[model samples]
Target: MSLKPNIVLVAALALSVAGCGKKEVDTLPPAPGPAPIQSQNQGSQTRIVPGSQADFSNRMAGLDTIYFDTDQFDIDDEDAVALRRQAEWLRQYPAKRARIEGYTDERGTREYNLALGERRATAARNYLVSLGIAENRLTVISYGKERPAVLDSTEAAWARNRRAVTLTID
Candidate 1:
C-alpha cells in the first residue's frame, strides 16, 4: 500500500518537473522589422549600354546611327529615321527608361567638350521627344573627352568618340 502511494507521488513530481522545463517558442517579433530601401542609382541592377552586339540585337535590332559633321548637334534627315525607330521602341516599352550619354573628341578644352557633349545628348533627346517620347523618361549626361569609344588620336577615332550612346535602365 505504501509503495503504491510513493509511486504515485514520484510520477506526479516527474510530471511537474517536465512541465517547468518547457517554454513556448516566440515567432512574431522579428517579422515586423523594417526593410532597407534601395537607392535608384544602385549599379548592380542598372541596364548595360546598348552598343554591344547582344544588347543592340535584343533592343535596337536593325536601328543604327547616322554620323554627324564635326561640332554639330543638329539631327539631319539621315539621323531622323534612327531616332524615330528609338522612339517607337520607347513607345512599345513604356516602363523602360534611357540615359543619353554624350561624348566628344579630344579637340577642345575640357569645359568646351563638356558643353558640346551636352548639346549633342540634348539634341538627340529632343529629337526623341519630338517623336513622342516623354522627356521625363530620358536622362542626359556628358562624358566630354573623358571616355572614348576609340582611344587612338586619329580622325576615325575622333569620329567614333564624338557620338551619343543610349543605355536602357529598368
Candidate 2:
C-alpha cells in the first residue's frame, strides 16, 4: 500500500469523527403570552382569556363571568349557582387564580358607582374565599359605571351592566 493513500484515508476518518462530536442544539422555547384582563379592582381564577394555559383551560371550562341584578352587590340564588361552579373548578385546580371585576349601570354618580363596583367585586371574591378558594389566589377590581356591559339607559341594559366578571389569570 502507498503511504500517501494511508495518510489520506486517516485524515478523512479523523475529519468524519470530529463532525460526530458536534451536537445539534434545540431552538429556544416560546415566549409567554400577555397578562390577563383584570378589572379596575386592583387587589385580585384560572378561567382565562389569552393568559396561561391553566387559565385558558378554566375559561374554556365555563368559569367566565357571573352576573347580578341592578344595584345589587349581593350574590343572589341564581348567581350563587354560577359561583358554585367557579368554586368547584378552583378547588379542582389549586394553582389557578382569578380576578373579580365589579361593574355597575350608568344610573349612579361616577364616584358612587365606582364604590358600588368595588363592593360587588369584593362580594364575589369573599364568596369565593368562603367556598374554600384561597383568598390569596383572588383579586378584586371595580370598573363601576366606567365599563358597563350595556351602554343604553333601559332597564335591561342597566341590568346587564350590574355584574361581576371573573377572569382567570396566571
- lDDT for each candidate structure: 0.77, 0.78
Candidate 1 per-residue C-alpha lDDT over 1-170 given as tens digits, one digit per residue, 9 for 90 to 100 = 47999999999999998888756777646555333232233464544443333454356654534355689888888678877877877887787787888889989899999999999889999999988899999999999899988899999989988887776667
Clashes of each: 0, 11
Q: Best candidate per lDDT, number?
A: 2
Model 2: residues with Cα > 4 Å off, grouped in runs: 1-63
Models 1 onward score TM values of 0.64, 0.64
Which stretch of 10 consecutive residues in model 2 shows the poorest summed lDDT?
38-47
On a 0 to 100 scale, what is the lDDT of residue 121 in model 2? 90
Alpha carbon RMSD to native, model 1? 14.6
Candidate 1's TM-score: 0.64
Candidate 2: deviation at residue 28, Å? 37
